[model samples]
Target chain A: MKALVWHGKEDIRYDTVSDPAIEHPRDAIIKVTSCAICGSDLHLFHNLVPAMLPGDIMGHETMGEVVEVGSDAKGSLKKGDRVVIPFTIQCGECDQCRRGNFSVCERTNRKKALGDKAFGHATAGLFGYTHLTGGYPGGQAEYLRVPFADTTHIKVPGGIDDEKLLFLSDIQPGDTVAVWGCGPVGQMTIRSAILLGAEQVIAIDHLPERLSMAAAAGAITIDFMQESVVDRLNALTDGKGPHKCIDAVGTESHVDFGQPDTVLDRAKQMLMAENDRPHVLREMIYVCRPGGVISIIGVYLGLVDKIPMGQAMNKGLTFRMAQAHVPRWTGDLLRRIEDGQIDPSFVITHKVDLSKGPEMYATFRDKADGCVKVMLQP
Target chain B: MPLTNVTGVARSEGDPRVQRKGPSSLTGPDRLARALGWFSVGLGLAELAAPGRLARALGLDDKEGLIRAYGARELASAVPTLSIDKPIGLAARIGGDALDLATLAPALHRDNPKRHNAAIAAALVAGITLLDIAAFKGVKAAHRRDGGAARDYSDRSGLPRGAAASRGLARKDFDIPPDYRAEGTVADAIPALPS
Candidate 1:
């Protein structure tokens, strides 16, 4: 089988590889159909988190068909069934799964626990996350072995078109988390504040494309590049601040502020705490209403410092973190997708083949490509 | 021994490369394999009764290794939800199990004139109930890992839930003290003031 493999920084190549077969009774073999390049994968290209080794298929977001099942991989998931996988490969049993922290399922990432000769690392494993994701061969290939398949992969409803449902891999859950994380999960979170069943959902980002897409999604888009989000955002709301706020613009994501330096101000500082770099996350926390919600969906690799613990403490503010539990909510998300409740397809600014990922990565890394997401085929 | 075991594997070609792949698919037996795979605070006698079958079904060649591995790493890998830090999210998480809105229509709410005021709160509750159904009732969104699979009601593995009283959420500090979930809270947090 041929697959895209990551070898060192900027060294991803499409190469032929061995066929995947079921090794565990619980394992299922999947013939890859489609996958997507994630912002986290870019971290590997920059060597930020390390271990972009040779022949490592680089991707986690995926959908495919069950070619074989290890008997243990059950629950009506049989040959020819289509499935969408969550970023974390988990066994639906265990204290973690019972608690919905499927990301840290006991069987998935326990390095020391699984014994000397085991499936993968002990830590929560991801597809093609290199060291972070247990170095599991990703699905950007022809055939792949899906361990704990029944637990990790959710079968999609038949008859749904592939192109529209693709965002379920990560983005759908991410968007859901934006609201869920900020509101209902607790009080005084940004997402709930900005989104509070408000007539207009206001969003602030430097990226025109993402901001516009957010606007199209019912948010009143504010370009931090042109005007300050805090000041200008009020006009969108009734000067009460956004009812809910979601910081989907992650650390690696670039915003095109009108300022020449394109430097981030409160937006970036509050979102993250630094050696003390702070912005986006904290800003979301800072800006929402007195009892509003703030949802932080940005990706982070390091510890943030000097968080507004005081602001969070005094205001009785609530904070909700983002983890895209897509597998858990796939069916509900799909209904929403099908009914046109949310159309994330608008976020797809560029389309490219699996072979063109490397070039797209370079372009995205340099912030030159207008690429927001790149879809791949196996 | 548990830690060194994996680094201690004897190589085999047919053995899984152990790299990540597309979101994989599942069969019926895989659900059994996944659930039975966990070894809780002591496997108890249940795991010992059926050794080989369970081991084979779960894809584990080393049973003792699994026990040790689960014992050593279980505390961390396991997502423990605490009771104290749980109040709000727990309420929301349990929305799936809560009473039907239609049934509670009388006591929880009275008739409305314009209905806009009551509708928003009702909508929020409805949204929470929907998510609770998805989150706790274990409904997978109608999508697959690889864009090819479909949803099946018969495809369920187990309950989908979040950590409420054990393995607390990572974002929050979980030093909530076990007693919080046990003999938690004094009565009357909800004021007795009349509406």
Candidate 2:
């Protein structure tokens, strides 16, 4: 089997590796048909997220036809069933999973001790993330070994495009929602907010292409470089801040002259002093309407500096953030896709073979040549 | 066994292992930059730890402090060279190479007893300087983002009924999860609630 393996910072290789086999009664093997290069993958590409060992396969957004199934998973999954493997591995029997908190399901992290040390408590194991999450080889290959297969997958019907189904691994907005960053996730978030009945969806980004995409979804666009994000957001809301602020750009906020704090954050990040650039977090807190909600779907790796907790406390804001408990929404989202309500395929801008995965990583990281999202077919 | 096999104790018995390596995302320049970065660390540590020995060999016995300072500079340059910010570290390295050449020039005078050693050192610096320049240029060219007309995605609304009709479409079938609802907090529902 060939897979994209993490060698070091900014080094991903399409290497030949041994094929996966069923290792437990709950494990299943899938012949991966499609996978994607996620924004969070860039964190690993840049070596920002720790505990990534060499030879680790790299990918998470994936779906495939099951080729083999363990005895325990046979009741729910079987050979030839097409399924989208959510990134987070979960034991359905856990208390967290029963409560719909699948991202923090208690029994999934195989390296629980290491995870506990790094995160205070071990969360769910994630495919291809890091050792702190489980160190499971990812699905960026011809095949993948899925642990807890019975409960960790979203089964999609045939006759749908893989592009629409691959994103089941990852929203809603009410009132006026301001989404920061117009990357792929940000674009999906904009459409979701509109579908979820937000009166207004304001997308913030400096890139013209992204702004145009956001505008297509009927969102008012703010080019932070051209105009003030804070002022424009306020003006759009009639001087009241947006009701909900969504941060899609997490650890690696774009560093620009307009955001001086981002520049300082970059410097600190280079010096190994800061884990995240929270420029967006600071802005969200400072500008969110009093008594408003802050919904963060973005992935924050670790510690962040200089968050305005005082403002959030005084304003009585509510902060909701997590890696998507994918199963919680996938069934409804899948129905929406089937019903022609929302199309997930709109976000994919680049499609290539799995061998080109290495170059695609660079193109996506540099945001070069109008590259937005890449889908790799194996 | 690969390092991952040893350290990834959590991995099950049937997981994949590397069979053969292939082309990497890392370009030639990136590998060169990394090699230069490690070289800098080694040379910098040697200079810092035995500046007196280096000065004596080059017949610049009075310049131990200067050599140590250059060592610190080398180490500082390595930080960025080894980081994702390779260009910055490579630029610093190029500057440090110039300083090294200048310092060696004085030691290369014929009157010095160890002029030959100084000349050898100067040649080595010059070689490394060329490599530094190459790595710097290669890295910049490899990662350069040229500005142009961006690919437009304005037509991709991803809504079959159009963006307008799609608004609140999901609300017809889905209610906000109770744990996730933000609109009806207890304080908002209760007018007499304290701030």
Candidate 3:
């Protein structure tokens, strides 16, 4: 099987690897049909996520056909079934899963102790993520072994294309969502927000191409480089700011100008003293309206420095953030896709074979050639 | 007597009553115990493979021996649970969890340099302990309900009922023609469908 294997910082190799097999009874094997490079993958590419080992497969956003099913998974999945495997692996029977918090599932994280030591708690196993989650070999390969398949994958309805149903793993309707960083997730967040009937969607980014993509998705774009993001957001929403703000940019946020804290954060990051540069988080806190919700779809690993918690507290803000519990939203999102509400494929700027993964990672990370999302076909 | 459908949906195709005997004659909690059995094996391997690294990562480099001993215990606990269909192995796991908590207690002291790491590790162990106890109780309850019927298959459904029923939607709702290329430029792959 060919896969995008992580070697080190900025070193991803499209290499031949061992084919995945069903390791557990509840596992299923999926021959990947479509996989996309995500902004968070850059975290691994840049060596920001600590527990990432050499030769770890990269990629999470994917959909495929079930090539094989284990005994336990046979109840919900079968060979030849087309399914969208969520990045977060969950055993649906767990207490957390019963409550729809699949990202905190107890049974999925095989390396719970590492997570416990790092984040004070173990998160659910995330495909292709670092050891902080379970180092489940990711979906960037030709075939992926999905654990807890009965609960982890959502069967995609036949008429709906992968393009339309891909973003269903994230984003819900009627959320007055404001997304920061117009990367792939951010662009999907924009499109999903519009489809979900969000009254308003504000997109913040410095890139021209990404902002244009957000505008194409019916969101109000803000070029953070040219203007004060806080001021623009306030002015756009009649001084109230957006009802919900999303930090689509995670730990690897970049700031061009040398603001004191951001400069210090950059210095710390360069010195290997801090793993996260939380500029987006701080900005979201400052720009979001009082009592507004802050939803983070961005990936934050290890410790984050200098969050404005006092202000967040004073404003009575509600924070909701996690790795998308892909299964939780898959059903409704697929239904929406079938209903012809939104098309997620609009975000894909480049599509290449699995072999182009190395080059595409750099292209997406560098925001080169107007690339917003790159879909890899194996 | 057992359901053998591809989707595993035929709950006892031959004898519906047998489905009620519970998964593998083991209760729901016992299944959880079996899961923990595998978890112990994974954890044990990590500990045994690199005790010093694990110890340092946990801020307890000085306790490498203790960590290795705990690893050995985890390996020991995993054996009976994996080999037998009894609840006693799960019960032993609960006991081992208690010992683990006791061992982790010292690291929770405010004065300890590694208190934060120790606290997190202890909390994790405590959580595992609670789960072990819950599985034990579940197994016992199932045993009482069935009057000790020794079944060969588990009764619990692996997938949610709603999700299972909707599984056919993939084949029913949309179809990607065999020749359809999902790759290349997004504009070329999926042209604007008539709105």
Candidate 4:
């Protein structure tokens, strides 16, 4: 099998690897048909997250037909079942899973001791993330071995295309909501807010293409490079600030001369003094209306420098964040897709063979050639 | 053994292992930059640990302190060179090369006892200087953004229904999950005080 492997910082390789087989009673092997290069994968590409050893396969957004199912998983999954594998792996029997906090579901991290040392408590195992999250080989290959397959997979219908079904594992909107970042996840968030009845959705980003796509979703766009986000957001909201703010850009905020703080954050990041750049978080706290909500959907790897907790406390803000409780909403979103309410395929700007996954990582990271989201076929 | 075999204690017998390596995301220039960065570390350590030996060999016995300072400079340049920001470190190396040549010029004089050794060191520095220049330019060119305008994606709304028609469409069947609601309905539910 051929898979994209993480070699080191800024080094991904399309390498031939041994085939995966069912290793546990609940495991299932799938012949992967589709996968994606997520924005968060850039973190691994840049070697920001720790515990990423060489030869680890790289991908999370994946869907495919099951070729083999272990004894325990045969009840819920079987051969020829098409399913979307969520990024976060859960046991579905833990107390956390019972309460719908699937991202923190217990009993999944194969390397729990290492995960506990790094994160205080081990969370759910994630496909292709790092050793701290199970060190499972990712789905950026011809086949993948899914653990806890009976509960971890989202069974999808055969008729729909892979693109529409893939983002289920990866939104709510409020009135006068402002979303930071306009990548694929951000773009989906924009449409979700509009569909959920937000009177106005403001999208923030520097890329013209991202801004334009947001506008097509009827969102008013803010090019952070061209104008002041704080000023424009306030003016749009009649000086009261937005009722809610969504952060889709996490950790690696764009380092630009305009956002001098981002420049400093990048310097600290290079020096190994900081793990995350919280420029977006800082701005969201500053610009959100008092008593409003702040939703974080972006993936932050570890510690962040200089967050304004004082302002959030004074304003009585509510912060909601997690790796998606995939099964909790995937079913609902799939129905919506069936009903023609939303289509997620629009976010894919590039589609190529799995062999080209290495170069696509570079292209997507640089945001060059007008590339936005990349979908890879294995 | 493959790297995975050594580090993959967590992996099971059935898990995938590397069979053959292929092309990497790192370009030729990026690999060159990394090699030079490691070279900088080696040279820097030698200069710092044995400045007296280096000075005596080059007939700069009186300039031990200066040689030590150059060692510190080499180590400093190596940091950025080894980092994702290679151009900065490469530029610094180019500057340091000029300094090395200037310091070695007087050592090449006919009267100097180690004039022959100084010539050899000077030639090495000149060779490194050319490699530094090439790596610097190659890195800059390889990582540069496309010179074309960004493609516009205004036609992609992702909403099958028009944006206006889709607003509040899900509200008919869905409500905000109780724990997720920000503005509390509990506050509104309470009777207001008489005005």
C-alpha local distance difference test of each model:
0.49, 0.89, 0.70, 0.88
Q: Which candidate number would show the highest TM-score if scored against the true structure? A: 2
Model 1 stretches astray by more than 4 angstroms = A50-52, A110-123, A170-196, A234-239, A253-278, A367-369, B1-195
Encode model 4's per-residue lDDT on A1-378: one tens digit a residue: 999998888999999999998888999999999999999999999888878888899999999999999999999998999999999899999999988888888889888877887789998999998888888889999999999999999999989999899888813344798999999989989888898889889999988888999999999999998899999999999897887799999988998878889878877787777988899999999998877778899989887888999998887677888888888888889999999999999999898999999999988987887888899998
* TM-score of candidate 4 relative to the true fold: 0.93
Winning candidate number (lDDT): 2
> What's the ranking of the predictions by TM-score, best on top?
2, 4, 3, 1
Superposition error at A139 for model 2 (Å)? 0.6
Model 4, span B154-191: residue lDDT tens: 89999998988999888788756676665553222222
Q: Candidates 2 and 4: which is better by lDDT?
A: 2
Off by over 4 Å in 3: A170-176, A258-260, B1-195
For model 3 chain A, where is the 10-residue window of minimal lDDT?
A167-176
Q: Report the C-alpha lDDT of model 1 over A301-342, residue by residue, as the tens digit.
A: 554554688776665444555455546556655665565434
- Over A1-378, each residue of candidate 3 has an lDDT whose tens digit, in order, gives 678887655667777666676777898899999888888887787677777766677888889999999998888898899888788989888898887788899888887876676678888988888867877778887888888889888787677667665555612233357889877778766655554456677888877766666665557878876888888888877886777788888887864554456766755665567878899889888877666677888888767788999989887677777777666666665665565444566676688988878767766655656666788998
Position A319, candidate 3: lDDT? 79
The residue pairs that clash in candidate 4, if any, are none
DockQ values per model: 0.02, 0.50, 0.01, 0.48
For candidate 1, give the lDDT of residue A28.
Answer: 86
- Of 2 and 4, the candidate ahead on TM-score is 2
TM-score, chain A, candidate 2? 0.98
